[model samples]
Target: MHKGNFKEMYLNTEQLDLGKFKVATSETLYMTVVSMLFVIIIGLILGLLLYNLGKSKRIGAKIFYNLLSIISNICRSVPFIILIILLIPFTKALMGTFLGAKAAIPSLVISAAPFYGRLVEMAFREVDHGVLEAANSMGANKWELVTKVLIPESLPALISGVTVTVITMIGFTAMAGAIGAGGLGGLAYQEGFMRNRPTITLFATICVLVIVFMVQWLGDWAVKKTDKR
Candidate 1:
């Protein structure tokens, strides 16, 4: 593996930012959690709508579903770095500054939401068709079908998707640091690559890895709990 030319020299440990470890961990967590809330909420709504509309026989519902599908595809297709740059103005407008933890949330959601939205749709699709037919035969209303049948049935899949989306966001959070977003990635960029302090950079990376491991462990537990089948 290429360790890069800078690794040949000793790092200046004194140049490390002492607060970086805490800031990196905090920023990454904050951005990941906050953005995930929005992603799950919006993704759920969009997923349900997409599924219902596509199932409907009405021409208008079909049109709306097609439009929504197109939009989700476009959002998912955009790269995270470009999406963050494009949303910088909006983030600044909303949070008054797009440089820190809060500023990074907007981009993180844009990058994760559509991805999770599709996951939600796929999860919902996995529900047994016989169950949906039974619910409908019993005159279950739209809300009942969605709340009782769709969501509950797909909970396990949603749990798994949440894990994947959150992990992806953590990586994006690091990339956001490249643009002064103030996370472990940013700390690594500044100390490891820019300052050429390899030790500080390596430490910041390990911190990220540990956090990812914890998240994965918890997510796996949740999936196991939710998956009765």
Candidate 2:
């Protein structure tokens, strides 16, 4: 392997334009934030449904739980890259294009929501059964049980799970960028790797790492604030 000069690589600015870098960074952040909102909202609802249905003794509820579980599993099992390709038609129909940051939102949400839903379900399951029993004995309704008891008790775990999910979404954005989604990943692939400019690739990678670290810090802070125990 031909290892280029490190100092020259770092100092070179001929190929790395700050303006384009900013645009790519914005695209990455946009995709991640937009998709994360949908993922969290939809995943939370799905998780709650799975939890409630699984707890019921009714045969119909059991059937529905199994059905949802299967679907969620299928979504989670598919790789994100293939999922994006598979959803191209849907993306075009929804976003009017399947080749930019906005178009990547549907694929990101679909791929990440079920994964986050499973995390939410696991977090809910980890809630203390004794607390649930106490709430039940006090004549708590289903809504009260979920909103006041279940979610509150599981808030810390939920935050932690969301933290993980957000990080995963960042990675998904990079993958989406690889195929013309126009983020740092696209910049790296097109302007750096293909054009033999290692500095731009390195720069984009560092930016991604910084974003991930910031996200991890915020998540930990949120979890600590919410955790009562």
Candidate 3:
């Protein structure tokens, strides 16, 4: 291709409206941030329960742990696109529609939470056993042990894990867009892919990369600040 043609291919904005681009970007951000909040909260709770239950000698706890483990594994194993389709009814019931940015949040949270929950469990596992023992000797109750000891000690890893999870969510947002979720992904699919406008797709991909890079930078900063060791 000639230089002029290449320039036109990328620089042509006649079909790619700036206003729509801005809206798509905002929608993507909204979906990612909102879904991430839920993912973190739910994932943390699931992780804590899994860890505590797995450690208990009680048969009931063990049975519950096994059941939870199976569920988490199934969720993590499902493909994101299939998961979205499977969740359409739930999303519609919850949001009253399954075709917009808001509707995508439920699927995003459900898809990511189990993955993040496993990461949280790993982070909790990495906490120094010696420190836990010390806390136990000091008569730290279960709540205190979790709140003050486990979370604080595993914070760096937790942050790092969340960084990865957030980036994954960013990608999930794009996939959500494919089905009219109204984000960069939708823009890419509808305008770029379906309409044969490669420039728009390229633009959307670039925007996603920028968001991922920013998240990575911020996550690294947070990990460094929190990692006292």
Candidate 4:
């Protein structure tokens, strides 16, 4: 292996455009934020629905739970690269081309929604049954029990779950870059892997690490701040 020169690599500026960095970073951030919003909305609703299913005796809560469990398991089990390719046709059709950040959004949303849905389900499950019963005793409707009691009580866990989802989306975004989406990953691949620029690759790697760590730290602090226990 040819060793990369750290000093030369750090000092080089041939391909280091701060503006492009800003643009790429902005696109990546937008993708993460927007996709996460969709994930939370879809996941939370599905999770609450599943939680209600588990509570009801109508169609055998056990069976409903098992079916959802299986579907979630299938989605979570697929490798991301394969998943991206699997969605390529749909992505191109939906966005007019599967060649950039916009193209990547569909796959990101598809993959993220199911993952966070399972996490949200777990978060909902963690809510105390007594609290739910008390809410019901006070004449709380299903929506009231969900929004007022279940979601509020699970806020800390939900934040933590969002943290996990963000970190995972960072990875997915990187993978999406390999498919022609222009982000740090795509930048790294173009400048480093394909063009033999070790400096760019190293910088991209460090930036991703920093972003992921900062997200986790912020998440931890938020959870701690909100936790009453």
lDDT of candidates 1 onward, in order = 0.87, 0.91, 0.94, 0.83
**Better model by TM-score: candidate 2 vs candidate 4:** 2
TM-score of each: 0.90, 0.94, 0.96, 0.92
Kindly provide the TM-score of model 2 when superposed on the true structure, using C-alpha atoms. 0.94
Q: Which ten residues in a row have the lowest lDDT in candidate 4?
A: 1-10
Q: What's the ranking of the predictions by lDDT, best on top?
A: 3, 2, 1, 4
Ranking according to TM-score, highest score first: 3, 2, 4, 1
lDDT of 3 by residue, 1-229 (tens): 9989987787677768888899999999999999999999999999999988878999999999999999999999999999999999998998999999999999999899999999999999999999999999999999999999999999999999899999999999999999979999999999998998878988999999999999999999999999998
* Index of the highest-lDDT prediction: 3
- Model 2 alpha-carbon drift over 4 Å, by segment: 1-4
By TM-score, the better pick of 3 and 4 is 3
1-229 per-residue lDDT for model 2 (tens digits): 3345775775477767999899999999999999999999999999988888888999999999999999999999999999999999999999999998999999999999999998888889999999999999999998999999999999999999899999999898988988989898888888888888988998998889999999999999999999997
Candidate 1 regions with alpha-carbon error over 4 angstroms: 1-18
- lDDT for residue 104 in candidate 4, whole number 0-100: 82
Model 3 bad stretches (over 4 Å): none
